[model samples]
Target: MTCRIWGRISSINVRKVVFTAQLLDLTFERVDAGAAFGIVRTPQYQQRNPNSLVPLLEDGDFTLWESNVIVRYLCARHPERGLYPPELQARFDAERWMDWQQTTLNPAGREAFIQLIRTPAEQRNAQALAASVAATQPLLAMLDARLASRRFMAGDTLTMADIPIACEMHRWWGLPLEHAQHPNLRRWYDSIRSLPAASGALDVPLS
Candidate 1:
């Protein structure tokens, strides 16, 4: 049976799972939920996920939420696909960047997305948007420097680490900020965008 993923595609968190599913070539039924779709608040959805978040994954009887965890679970389920390495250090290395995306990059870039995309021009907070852009540059510069040595986030091949950060990059790049030129980061992001999964998930119209 195909796994079930509950989330709206426009969500960056939901894109993480959608990208992962495509990367792993797993058949999944992505039920529209959350935001404009409106099923996330229902009693049934809350039962599956108390936090009532999108990108919930259900494989048979096993259910998981939190976007990164769902990505990790999918990678683990398809270890031979090499998205998540089995070696302790390699796996953790990938995990660290994934956490960094959730902890640092996503939060830092969010205001820019909200202000530029979601907020109408007059109502947007300039200071918050500026601060958000400033906060995101260093995080991206760190990634740029890291990619100066590696083709992808972890080392060479694409891994679970790249998915969330890449989606975050999509968000950042989609915005109209005066981008800090991180050549290597741009190169790496361009490479990731070429992936089959990326074309549909990360390269879509930001909404």
Candidate 2:
């Protein structure tokens, strides 16, 4: 089945799906649809994804949205590839980190990213930036502790959990903030950075 992803290449959320597709060796087409491209708001695009968000995935007759959900679908459908573990407990453990990324880390990272990259220098809010950094530190520390014990977030094997968290980690580290030392996290990130998909998709500079 041919896969098409609608989103700009630079979006971290889009990057996660793109990386997952690449990891699975799935051939896909990507169309620029968000931000500067302005295609996401079109009527036809709205029909496919009413939210008009980037990273909408179309697999022949099947359509999916939300980057994390798309990744899960891709992994579950291709179980032998081992992207998503079959074990219920292990899968849930991996999923917990993915949820944490959405519920906790992304909000904090988005604040810092907007202030540092999107907002103009003259209008940037130092107070907001500081708050974002403070909110993100504890999460990074938690990841650090996890990485200290395991080679990957959920365990030694790389899983769906790594994709979203890695995307956010790239953005977090890209910002010009004084971050806490997380040696294990740094090491795990560096290891993933060497992977072909990560080197191509997750290594983009913060926008």
Candidate 3:
């Protein structure tokens, strides 16, 4: 059976999985399933992913959720691509960055995204958006510093670490707010954004 992914393209998490799948040249089908699409709350989707989240993956009889974990699983299946990173320390370093993207960076920027993109202008929360921008800016600076010395998140080559972070950056950059230019981060992001494989995922307009 062809691999199937459930999620809308507008979601950063879903984009990560889609970008990873594209990078690996994997044959898969992506279904629109969240937000206005409204399929996630269905009983069938809930059975496959109790969280009822976007970006659920089903390959044959196996099912998986959590975007980053799905990325890891897909990359692991295609070890020759080396996106999973074989070296012990390198693999862990990738894991740490991926975790940081989810736990730290995403939370900090989420409110800004919500207020600016999702919420109507009249209903937007200025204080919350300000706080979210403040929290996320420092993290972006840290990522800039991290990428200054390396071509990619884990090292010279694109790995699982780069997928989620790149998707996050794509979302951040798409926002209408003024942003301080982080040259190295921009450089890295541009390289990834320019990839043929990243066309659909990274190039999509922000909702």
Candidate 4:
């Protein structure tokens, strides 16, 4: 069944779903309906997703939200992609990093993106921006340590975990912050940068 994915192209959350769909090579349609293109508040859209968030997925009659969950759903349709592992521990290993990106990485990482790119220089909060960058560094260090041997988040292969985290890294790296280098994280990112979906979506300027 063809899926209908809704979100603006520039949204990092939406990029996660887009990359997952492209990686799966699934038949789908993407509807622009968030941020400035505001269909998310429409009555019909709200009925489908009351949260009014971008990156909503509709597969036949099945609807899903939260970008990482949408990635999981799309991967389920094409098990051969190996992006979502079936084994319990392996699956959770992917899920764990996915959750950490949302709860830990994104929160800290978004600071510099917003302050430097979104906020005007005169209006920027220098202290909070610096603190946010500081908070995000050790988290990248954590992933660096994890990637010290493994080529990907879970193991040697790409999995659902890397989708959201990669978007987060793209945001962090794109900004002009004086970031502490995470060698292993940089190594993993360089390897994945060649993926068409990732190159097309995450390589864009931070917005």
TM-score of each prediction: 0.97, 0.97, 0.98, 0.96
As for candidate 1, its clashing pairs are none
Model 1's TM-score against the true structure: 0.97
The global C-alpha lDDT for each of the candidates, from Candidate 1 onward, is: 0.90, 0.89, 0.95, 0.87
Model 2 segments more than 4 A misplaced: none
- Clashes in predicted model 1: 0
Better of 3 and 4 by lDDT: 3
Candidate 4 Cα lDDT to native: 0.87
Candidate 4 C-alpha lDDT tens digits along 1-207: 789999998899898898888888878899998989999999999988999999899999988888988888888778888887999999998999999899999998788888999999999999989888888888888999999989999998999889889888888899886777788989899888888767567777777
Residue-wise lDDT of candidate 3 within 1-207, one digit each (tens)?
589999999889999999999999999999999999999999999999989889999999999999999999999999998899999999999999999999999999999999999999999889999999999999999999999999999999999999999999999999999999999999999999999989999999999
Is 1 or 4 the stronger prediction by TM-score?
A: 1
RMSD of each: 0.9, 1.0, 0.8, 1.2
Model 3 alpha-carbon drift over 4 Å, by segment: none
- 1-207: candidate 1 lDDT, tens digit per residue: 799999988999999999999999989898989888898788999999999889899999999999999999999999999998889999999999999888888889898899999999999999998898888878888988999998999998988999998888888898876787899999999998887777679877888
Please identify which of the two predictions, 1 or 3, would achieve the higher lDDT against the true structure: 3
Better of 2 and 3 by lDDT: 3
Ranking by lDDT: 3, 1, 2, 4
RMSD of 3: 0.8
Which regions of candidate 4 deviate over 4 angstroms?
none
Which residue ranges in model 1 land beyond 4 Å of their true spot?
none
Error of 2 at 159 (Å): 0.6
Query: Across residues 1-207, which tens digit of lDDT does each residue of candidate 2 receive?
Result: 779999987899998998899888888999988999998888998989999998999999888999899999998988877989889999999999888899989997788899999999999999998898888888888899989989998898999989889888888888887777799999999888888877568777777
